[model samples]
Target chain A: MGKKTNLVGEIIQDPKVKPLSPHLQVYRPQITSVLSITHRMTGVVLSVGSLGLASWIIAGAFGEQVFSVAQLIISYWISQLLLFAWTLCLFYHLLNGIRHLFWDAGKGLEISQVTWSGWFVVSSACVLNIIFWLIAYGFFAKLV
Target chain B: MAREGVSHWWYQRLTAVALAPLTLWFVWSTIQLMGVDLAGFRAWLSGPVNLVLSTLFVCTLFYHMKLGIQVIIEDYVHDHVLNSLGLIATNIVSVVFCVLTVVSIFVIVFGS
Candidate 1:
């Protein structure tokens, strides 16, 4: 019993054993929490997606042959799908990020405003992605 | 430590503000570039305004990326040594990519 008590004491004294703030699992997801986490997730996605952007520029640097190959690769269906998703992530990140800036500026702290803005961000992102891609593929491609 | 934290937050927001418009411009430009040949694309970027804005966008982007990833690493990585290593790696990756992008753009714009 004494040893068990000492073990408990040791565990209590451990810095890492301190109680953590309730994490994601502890809370039912709400729009605020959901959008907050999505912001971070999409930020990470954009970081990775920048690789495609980097590759395109690098290919351009290497001259016509490399640039053509890069263009061909990007034209593939799989690449198009990834590009579409990347743009979605981009628009979401952009709009939500602006919301964050407004919050930082001490506006939109009300829960209703937060929820409304969250929905707006999500919807706008989708619409913008579709419109952006349609014009790129449909309208601009034809002009080219 | 407090000052450093504030500076990090400040720069993150600063870059975000810069990126908002730059992103829109980039998206518009990408749409305009659609189905253009390499020469045509190169010629577009070769424009002085496009060159400057694209360079600024690339630089701001990777710096922001590094800062954001550092925050994630700080949040998730518990080990002191590992967290530092993660930050260093993030910095290295961001710098390398940023340099590669800027240099590539210069080459595309100016190279024969």
Candidate 2:
């Protein structure tokens, strides 16, 4: 049997070569660019995290047996790690969401200031997540 | 002259304004519910105030998420089909999640 033709090869083999649009590698990263990309990434993460919430709710509705199973899974070491990651994603998404709201309001798009603020928001989200986890695990001894 | 961008600006502002209190309440509620057992958690959520506040929070949160995600997809996804699909899927998922949240709240609050 003949080998299947790759789409890219077929397109490239065409006699009429169209000029391609500029790609990501051609452009420098700016604050808005970084924030925009990170926002989408965090949004995707949060979307996945919603599934965890859904599982909890459905388990709660089902009854205690299911809830106990969920509790065991959530309290497991690996699940705890994932939960910590999800919490960081949540905070990052929330902070960047606020930043996007500001930009949507026609503010904070200035090059220098926006860049610094973007960094600040990312850093603050990490720090705040750590503080929250510390309070949860240390003070409360909840380990979550 | 009527400002051309005022509508976009106002809508964004409205969502932001709504999200402020809702987000705060959501965080506060989460913190308060930290260590409660199932029945205890359900009892706390069963209150009229908590149920109502959660309803408001879920609605506002999904609305804000839709608006934010719409802009992101509009800006980044260059392919028309993919962009439209993303936007439609975002709307569908948010609506479904909103409904689920409300239903869960009712189950928690009203269901014995």
Candidate 3:
């Protein structure tokens, strides 16, 4: 069989495949990796949350009836759970974002410190989210 | 290669620094509005302080989102055409959403 020719036909193509470099599979999971993955995950979550914001704006613009319907949906138990999730996502994204900012500024790139701080940020995000939900529910429970 | 210093990093830090308290206030305001009627919610939002906070929250939130999304696209999307398009689209959407959010705040605060 004739060899396949290309625009540059004189060049011989190498038949052997190059060795694939090690990727995510090779490394042990660590806090920095967890936080890095979570940051992107929460970014996506917040993107979805932005749609909720859009809905709120549109409903508010339309009229009271439409707004009330949205209010009803959002106030439901399941929706409240979603809101809590969204709130957590917000805080996580915010904390990790600050971490990224610090890294960008050429600080905290030390292996030990970076991983330690990543865990700290993640833990702080969880604690803050819990406190926020507690306060929100405390106020909300009063109104009910 | 572009210079490797802390300017971009500083901006992100600054944005997060500003957003910290603003986010807390936003969460509080949103919770306060829970179960309140439309009029009640509107009245709260219409108040000058709430309007200002809401405006700031929306603007900062979109700004942060834009910055984060831009970095993500730059890192993962290798194709020059796709990366540029994604960057542009992200900016456009973020700006439009910010404007819409601000406009809605104004309508709530002043339209009534």
Instruction: Point to the candidate with the largest TM-score.
Output: 1
Q: Please estimate how well model 1 matches the true structure, expressed as its whole-model Cα lDDT.
A: 0.91
Better of 2 and 3 by lDDT: 3
Q: Is the docking of candidate 3 incorrect, acceptable, medium or high quality?
A: medium
Inter-residue clash pairs, candidate 1: none
What digit string (tens of lDDT, one per residue) describes model 1 on residues A1-144?
A: 333336446523455567678775889889999998899999999999897789888989888899999989989999999999999999999999999999999999998999999999999999999889889778666878
The digit string of per-residue lDDT tens for model 3 on A1-144 reads: 576667877644557856567777889987877778888989878976986876686578667898889888988999989988998899888787777767877999999989788888878988988988876678556767
- Per-residue lDDT for A36 in model 1? 86
> Per-candidate DockQ versus the true complex?
0.75, 0.31, 0.51
* Candidate 1 C-alpha lDDT tens digits along B4-78: 898999999999999999999999998888767789988899899999999999999999999999999999899
Off by over 4 Å in 2: A1-15, A20-22, A140-144, B1-13, B68-88
Alpha-carbon shift of residue A142 in model 3 (angstroms)? 6.8
Model 1, residue A1: displacement in angstroms? Answer: 22
Candidate 2 residue pairs that clash: none
Whole-model Cα lDDT of every candidate shown, in order: 0.91, 0.73, 0.80
Per-residue lDDT of candidate 2, residues A17-80 (tens digit): 5667777778898767877788778776766676576567656666667766776777788977
What are the chain A TM-scores for all the models, listed individually?
0.82, 0.80, 0.81
**Chain A TM-score for predicted structure 3:** 0.81
The runs of at least 3 residues in candidate 1 whose Cα sits more than 4 Å from the true structure, single-residue gaps closed, are A1-19, A139-144
- Specify the highest-lDDT model's number: 1
